[model samples]
Target: MDNRFNFSVPDICDDHADKVQVSNLRLQSFGGNDTFSGPIETINCPDDNSLVKEILNTPGKNRVLVIDAKGVSHASMVGDQIAAKAESNNWNGIVVNGYVRDTEVLKTIPLGIYAIGSIPKKTDKHGLGSIGNDVFVGGILIQSGNWLYIDSNGWVIAKNELKF
Candidate 1:
């Protein structure tokens, strides 16, 4: 899809032309907030076992899944396995403000996952988390029912559906 009309947080914040800066070989793209305007479904989990199943069942045909991992450093919140599930389910993408595992594998999938870093350890399955709620990360308000736009440049959120 042509991203020229798409709004990128990084470029907008920099007062530069709307241009998406593609990353290098799955490298960090400087992590920017994507503007989103739609229904918000928050998934707060440390492991993919529970979240993965829920993600697979999610009806995100054209919506985004914002996951709040509580910025946990113990383990990864999302990974390639869950990403694959999301892709197969036709989800727009996943935004994890926490850590993710299996970068190499995740890159292979078309899931748009934004996270802090990668971890080698997986999360423990305890079936603990909240779905369909508001979540805040990096002091950014990610309320339910908001539109989130993401790209190679960065991410941004809009209170309502925006036109570029």
Candidate 2:
């Protein structure tokens, strides 16, 4: 799918603040692409990236994967390998409520990655997590199928896809 909405977060907020919910957290960008938007696919996992790997292996159709890592900072939730898969799978972006590793490689991929920070340690592949569920990140309730707009400014969630 082509990128229809290329506007920034502040611009969207200025026009449709009443129709959008902005995430409170100031997530850091680590991907080659800094701006991306798409339908949300939520995952709730804690210190385990088994589900993350599972989803990235499937087709993305330009959708964004929102991983709720329960705010774990001890270990990385995503790294270069997984992110490369996401890019190859046609995923537009990935938003992690936790840390990610391989920052150098992540900066080279075409995917847009937003996370709290970076860590060298990897996550445990316990295959523990739930998919297609509502996840809370930065105090914003991000539900599956919701439209997510992310840029260098921040992220905004809308009930429906918005065109600028």
Best by TM-score: 2
Per-prediction TM-score: 0.74, 0.97
lDDT of 1 by residue, 1-164 (tens): 43423455565546533432222222232122233223445666655447645665756665677777766767877667677777677666667766777877777675566776778788787777777667775566676666665665556565655444
The candidate maximizing lDDT is: 2
Residue 150 of model 1: what lDDT? Answer: 60
Quote the RMSD, in angstroms, for model 2.
1.3
- Candidate 1 stretches greater than 4 Å from native: 1-7, 10-39, 46-49
Could you tell me the lDDT of residue 122 within candidate 1?
Answer: 83
> Per-model C-alpha lDDT, please?
0.60, 0.92
Model 2 misplacement above 4 A: 1-5
Q: How accurate is candidate 1 locally (lDDT)?
A: 0.60
The window of 10 residues in a row where model 2 has the poorest summed lDDT is 1-10
